[model samples]
Target: MTPSPESVTTMLYQHDDNGALLRTDLPFPRRSGKVRDVYDLGDNLLIVSTDRISAFDFILPSGIPDKGRILTQTSAFWFDHLDVRHHLLSTEVPEALSAQFDTEPLVGRVMVTEKASVIPFECVVRGYLEGSGLIEYQQTGEICGNRLPPGLKQCDRLPEAIFTPATKAEEGDHDENVSIGRMIADLGSDLALGLRKRSLDIYRKACQYAESRGILIADTKFEFGKVGDEVVLIDEVLTPDSSRFWAADDYQPGQAQPSFDKQFVREWLSTCGWDKKSDPPALPPEIIQRTKAKYEEAKKRLTQSEPTL
Candidate 1:
């Protein structure tokens, strides 16, 4: 059963021994993303989901407790259920490295994955109009260079799920949405179109499953990579951070809907009076607890399993 927000509040607001894992020093080569620190392990990669959370392209001063575990578990759930080629190999960190790193940091938060040559675009599938899509529709009545029917309100379901590709951004830079034509120019028509097809397929299947679980997958981003002649899904799958999930019972199309992700963090940041140019204000304890509850609720709804320590 899902834990209540009040029940998780105390634990969720407490910091990890290592506060907001900014980076990791491992024997292997590592690259730190906004929330993950990945270690390159020759033929495989060790992907560690950290407690860190990012907003407005900036890593926040605080993190939601157990966030790493929630994301890792949620992605593992989807990767296990999805009928497609993916890069996940195992969620276990090697026993040999057990002594090298603290078990607390690695437990339920790491994956040993088959490495692939990662694609440089984000394959975004949107089922509802919000965020950039809403903004784009208001300005030009289009999204990802695809024209939409007139008079679509905020959070309204699209005519159908649309695959909108965007160029992957550098650290601290914004990811810019690109047209299908642009994607074709960047990675050939065959591969670009293939990404779109796979993205839409995954989104549709996920939507059906999430709806059954009382969650609406508004949209999600996917990263893919080339392994020999085939492109397989890589990076994180549909976790709260990657997808916009709304409570199915409370969903309303005309306005922003209550969500089960970092929408709370984003909303708080938007009104916190911090200039985008400056360091983001630290998230209040209440905000942290609320965010943690959202991530946990998302995992519970989709997987219907308690998070393992």
Candidate 2:
């Protein structure tokens, strides 16, 4: 039987010491991403958000407690609240599989979705300057062909949200940023324009809502897929794992701001002296706890009250 949401939460906390679920063993064709395990269920896909965390294009040796639950539940919240066509069919595990495998570990971390031909590009929307965007701006005062005014500081809010798409890289590879013209050239003008409009609309609405809740969605990426000729949003939506979320109250434009995502992991990895080309180090217990807390806090603040959208 499917456990109640309350029961699932209880189970997650109780099972924290059992360690992060690094992998799954279901008897189905599966594809593992940096943090999710996708199982083919014929008509639909079963996506299990694992606790595995990746930084510098490498899956780290350590996992954060309850990280899977945070990402899955957070995405579920957005799927329900966002007014758009999406690939999510349900969050409940099918009875056929639940009856066969021990599903207690899957509660609050599984999504049953309609399988679609995933688009090859990531739809990235930025409302602020940071990350690779900031670096590119520093060098050429442009990001993915979008020109910006001079003297913009790091983390400064952009004049408006910009849709900067990137090629969805293979596992262990970096996603390369590209211009909208490139996207239009690759994927006809109509389809490319449609994606840009949809992505920007969703980002604007989500950012507004997030700000009202004391969080700033500085930037985020969305993935789309085609079920026949209809394009729909797929994959995780606005989760910390896919977005740069900052505390609205702590906003500062000239320097790097504190974020709710995996900043701690990246910071540690950068300062630990691990060469970017080699295997990353396991996160210390303190880093794990701090990272987990950031994710949990983001989930709580963003989903505490449902938006009217």
Candidate 3:
């Protein structure tokens, strides 16, 4: 059974004053990413989503309270609902490590997954014009070699969703958008085509369901991995951190639309006069609270309505 959002928030903040699990100390081989700490557990992996948040490729010092739990639970919701082969094995922490580590911090934010050879590209699907996609369209009338219809306004829904793949960048670097042909050249025709089809299929289904729940998934990126000969969806799926989610009732196409992700943090950072090069400044308490509310609202909206997929 899924716990209520209020209950989860209470549990998360009861112990820590800041209400952020910034990091985890585990006795396993670990690789810490921008927001998640991944520990290798022999055949499987223990992925712990921390409250750490990043923007403009920099990890911010302040974290949104309960952000990790929201992300993890949101991904778990999709993993259970979406009809796709995915890497999620379970959300429960393994029994062996229960005695060694404090389980309080890990609850609702842990995923035990099968480790697979990660595909080096981010499979991006866009149903709307925004972000880098909009900038590219304005300049060349295309995005990642997909020729978009001319005169498309900002946030305008595309006639059809398009698959745009990007090369995964190193830590603290940006992922470069590349053409589909480039994906085929590097990953071969069969594999590239397969990934594109899978990504689009998932996006279409998710878009339909999310729209019904009063949210529009403007765009989202997916990661896939190989387990022996089979390709499976890997990493977080359709979470606010990985996807651009907009309030359906409030959306307008002529200009930038309000989002449910870390856009507030980005907006704050953009105007705070901090150079994008150096260490990022800490977010104010109000920004943190507002950001946390946005993420919570998204999780509540998407997970509350269960539809036949």
Candidate models: Cα lDDT each = 0.86, 0.89, 0.90
Give per-residue CA lDDT, model 2, range 1-309, as digits (tens): 988866554543333343887877577898989888899999999999989988877888889877988998899999998999999998888899767646877877899999999989999999999999999999999999999999999999999999999999977678999999999999999999999999999999999899998999999999999999999999999999999999999998999999998999999999988997877777789899899989988998999933111
Q: Say which prediction, candidate 1 or candidate 3, comes out ahead on TM-score.
A: 3
Global Cα RMSD, each model:
6.7, 5.2, 6.0
Query: Residue 299 in model 2: shift from native, Å?
Result: 0.2
TM-score against native, each model: 0.91, 0.92, 0.93
Winner of 1 and 2 under TM-score = 2
Residue-wise lDDT of candidate 1 within 164-221, one digit each (tens)?
Answer: 8989998778899989999999999999998999999999999999999999999999
Q: What is the lDDT of residue 273 in candidate 1?
A: 89
* Candidate 3 residue-wise lDDT, 183-223, digit = tens: 99999999999999999999999999999999999999999
- Candidate 2 whole-model C-alpha lDDT, 0 to 1: 0.89
Candidate order by TM-score, decreasing, is 3, 2, 1
TM-score, prediction 3: 0.93
The top-ranked prediction according to TM-score is: 3
Q: Under the 3 Å rule for N, CA and C atoms, how many clashes does model 1 have?
A: 0
